[model samples]
Target: MALQDQPAYLIKMRAKPGLGDKLFALATEGMEKSGSSDRFIIAREDADPDVLWNMEVFRSHEAKDAYENSPLADELRDEIIELLAEPPMRIEVHPYSALPDGPA
Candidate 1:
């Protein structure tokens, strides 16, 4: 498949007041230990410290689906639900990939 059509998952999460740090720590830990994502982009909103945006890219939809249903993912999902100020929002995105002019 062409790079631009690659399937990915984009998530928007909001932590409870004063709990952004804890949420970030948990997410980082999970991403580091997990093989579900080939790329991860995580950012905290500057204006709203309680907001987090995450973009996770995988090799395929199958890989993404597998990771979402794993035991570790289930545990993390439960934990995140408790830490959230409101329900988390997620959407599937097709991203443009493969650096065209870069060394790669």
Candidate 2:
């Protein structure tokens, strides 16, 4: 089924030294629990060693809310918080449409 009204969220994090691997592992676990592996992306920017970017897409705001309210999500948030040097930066974007000729 295609998502009718999905929203994209961009999350930027500043991590402590050597915490990237742990963060990625925790994110994977959280995504699995939320049934959102298809919408999760984690990337390390070459320009900054302490910076990581996380992008998540959901079918709607309600889906995002549900994931956030899940027990597994709470546990994952706590674990991620402990590993981060500061709070993550999150931005929401609207996906207007998709291209017809390319892979989504």
Clashing pairs in 2: none
4-84 per-residue lDDT for model 1 (tens digits): 555787889999999999999998888877787777889999999889899987767777788878999999989988999
lDDT, candidate 2, 18-96, per-residue tens: 8977887787677767874336677888887667788777766777788778888888888999889888999987555
Q: Which residue pairs overlap in candidate 1's backbone?
A: none
Off by over 4 Å in 2: 1-4, 36-38, 98-104
Worst 10 residues of 2 by lDDT: 93-102
Every model's TM-score: 0.87, 0.79
lDDT over C-alpha atoms for residue 95 of model 2: 56
